[model samples]
Target: MIQKNKYLIGVIALLALALFTVPCLAMEGPDSIELDSLAELYEPVQFDHIMHVEAAGDDCSVCHHHTTGTPVQDENCIGCHANSGEADEVACSACHPANRFQADYLNKIDENYRLNHVDKVGLKAAYHIKCMGCHEENDAPTGCQDCHTRTEAGDKMFRSGKYAPKGGNKSRKSGH
Candidate 1:
């Protein structure tokens, strides 16, 4: 009986450890998430999700922009954003009442974007703030050209090498 109990206890401990560690190690962010949320501003920033994950050393929540325990994977983003359970999974513009065709759309010449953008934090603001903020925080490039280089030559260069931070040859500090 004693030996059997010891084996059971050991198995339980291993199972518990595996349950916790697997999610941390296996939280696979998509390789390249297109941040077309703000395409009107720039030519839809194709964010290097994998690069960001490696740079932040596996802190997936930063770009995910969610709390560690937030109820997620229940549905895609549009479900909550459009405020409907039956809402169709579609382009953001499908439900959002914003005028994308306006000339000022790209420029964000509207004063709300210029002054109070952070308050409501629209799709454009969310992407920009998260991406640009992380870049600025990490001393990464904030220049639009640095990220949005999707030209013929640029695509070749981008795919050729894995992106590391300016001084981050090694991965960021690991936590588990």
Candidate 2:
């Protein structure tokens, strides 16, 4: 039977890539930080998702990680959640580059972030406009909770750690 119809179409494409990358890693951003030990100056140290999705390979779209109406393009995490100016982009001056006055005062505190009126910008100015502008253009820790936190430092950065393939810590879940 054609090998059981190719094993039922490879178990229906691995159950439609786990219903599209398990809710895009169960959506995040409740001040997202599964364990950023503060030390990646330019390219190394965002680990702590149970050690980067299980030693960098459990596949959450394999770094191509994405969200917004999924398609599961090999597990796109959009190379670190795209849209900072697109193209190989990681935004926030793509590594803090408005000429570094402390990443230009945290990009002017992310263009004067607000809160209640909602023009708000707290994730430490969207994570210093994207992970301390690439760890301060490769220097790291722009201080201030090292990335913003309020309620008891977001409950001590969500109890510090322990996300593995068994749920991969989505922080709060918010994708479709």
Candidate 3:
């Protein structure tokens, strides 16, 4: 009887340890994440994930929605996902498609009647919306250059630097 009691206690102890440590393990993430998904015209953003995590007070729901097993805080999402639980993947790109305007992606969204994600923004828009909203609220920088440095390709596209309009916007005389 005593041997059985000892074995039960050991199992209970192990279960308790697992329960407490599981959440911590789930919250663990890389210190930094290189954001290069939309780095065509701009350099990749070296995102300091740890810093944002601290700024968010370690609340994963702030950015991850209800994917981190945290309660849904956004009123728009609370209706359908109040108790939806943790997701298999939490990365923004996992749900928000990069080629959201593509014909196939549009068709997929159109066919999925059960998913009420029709209004969901694309990956780039998602990043901008989430980041810019927070930055605005916290009085952080919202300028394009504040987060992303334009690449040489971007400069050329924008007609800036060496690509600036030659002759300083000279007016062309129309021959009548």
Candidate 4:
């Protein structure tokens, strides 16, 4: 009976550890917070968190930008979005009304983007202006080969995934 009880306790502990670790290792499911862009649904591209964490030396602060000189809390992309220097920045919900368009977040543009003829911005331009701009300045890969493969000579990196869902779904309709 003593041996049986010890075995049962060990099994319970193993089960609990498995339940938690499986989700962290799995590429799919909400439990994993990989590739969390508002554009995710529009793209459905699963970011390899394990891969990035390994390559980037486990620095959670690498992707997070905060004015407080501290890392952002987990699962909070908007903290950085709201950190943009633009004076007239709007909420992600304003453009991504129905919570749809899944490249990860609503593809927000600066008001001056339209003034500069960037209103009908596509994924590539938006990503370049917003994400890649910083990555490039930091000596990161501004080219497709850095984050993705180039199937063609002129293929854009923003559209470099296995699939590129066209914009027009009701869930992803533009707020502007």
Q: Single out the weakest 10-residue window by summed lDDT for candidate 2.
A: 36-45
The model with the greater lDDT, 1 or 3, is 3
Higher-lDDT candidate of 1 and 2: 1
Q: Find the candidate with the highest TM-score and give its number.
A: 3
Model 2 global lDDT (CA atoms, 0 to 1): 0.44
Candidate 1: residue 51 Cα off by (Å): 1.4
Report how far off residue 81 is in candidate 2 (Å).
Answer: 14
Arranged by lDDT with the best first, the candidates are 3, 1, 2, 4
The alpha-carbon deviation from the true structure for residue 108 of candidate 1, after best TM-score superposition, in angstroms, is 22
- Residue lDDT tens for model 1, 107-175: 554555654222334455555676788789889889867877544444445543343235646676778
Runs off by more than 4 Å, candidate 1:
1-21, 67-120, 149-176
Q: lDDT tens digits, residues 1-176, model 2? A: 99999999999999986776564442332222343433332222243444434433444433323433333453233454454222344222244333333566566657767622223343334444544554666576677455444344444455442321355556876786
The best candidate in terms of lDDT: 3
The C-alpha lDDT values of all candidates are 0.53, 0.44, 0.86, 0.44
Candidates' TM-scores?
A: 0.42, 0.22, 0.79, 0.26
Report how far off residue 169 is in candidate 2 (Å): 41
Query: Poorest 10 consecutive residues of model 4 by lDDT?
Result: 23-32
User: Candidates ranked by TM-score, best first?
Assistant: 3, 1, 4, 2
Q: List model 4 lDDT by residue over 46-103, tens digit each.
A: 4555655444443333432332223334345454444443223222223323433444
